[model samples]
Target: MQKKYQKISATSGIMTFDLELNSEISKVWDLIATTKGFAQWFPELSIGEPGVDGLILFDFGNGEYEEMTITVYEPQSILEYTWDKNMVRFELVGQDNKIKLRFTEEINEKTTHTPRDISGWHMCLEKIQGILEGKEVSFTEDEFLALFDEYQALMN
Candidate 1:
């Protein structure tokens, strides 16, 4: 499925993507909410705790870690957390047997890293979809760069 991206507010710097997956809500929930499921697609994800106010550590396997705090947690429905100067939110909705996932990133300001982050999220979503479909999929650096260029042009 083609992903949809929208600018919630240019002034507020909010951006969002709506993704539809051919999977059940429960499966989708696991992929986003559980540490083991998260590791399937996001190999660097490690959570100190399992709920709200917990520490989410992202280790790039380079001995460097980016820590973020989970601000909201509702199993199988909502997951939100602090990401640097912004907040990332994931909302899941079930329709029949399929699932709809809405991802929102609240940006404080547009920076050089904005497009990079957007592209990364885009790839992540794709990876999640692949996992749900039982397909081995990943994006190369070149694919990311292409996606980054697309987001950069869209932002401009």
Candidate 2:
């Protein structure tokens, strides 16, 4: 049920996509707004709650941990949060038999931003795109080490 997907690219202060999915708002929300659903793609994540004061703890078991605070949550409508001072928002627009999922991840320091997080979201967004079309997959974290090494190589 994916209608359109915006390719991810590095920007001066952020990296994100404006995605369109052709699925029920409830179903799509369940995937992104739930712990188990998120763990499907971000295997390193251990979500606490989906409330305003909740925290998303993601640890790839590689000595790195990402902590994000949920500042806003409105079921299948709107979700906003902060990660390392970066504001991440998910705006849900309902359409006929589908919903438009807009994701904007803004970080002040792109050069210091973690590529692992970006790549993880990259894979997650791709799977979300596929899942809505009934061709989804379970992206794993077994590639964390390799991906970390790869990112380091790219940076150096």
Candidate with maximal lDDT = 1
**lDDT tens readout by residue for model 1, 93-119:** 887678889998888776888889889
Q: Name the lDDT value of residue 11 in candidate 1.
A: 36
Give Cα-based local distance difference scores for all models.
Answer: 0.83, 0.69
Q: How do the residues 1-156 of candidate 2 rate in per-residue lDDT, one tens digit apiece?
A: 222222234533445566878888887887788877776666676667778888877785988887888898888887778866567777788867767887767654455446676655666787887877878665567776565555444433
Tell me how many clashing residue pairs each candidate has: 0, 3
> Any residue pairs clashing in model 2, and if so which?
1-22, 1-132, 1-133
TM-score of each: 0.88, 0.70
Best by TM-score: 1
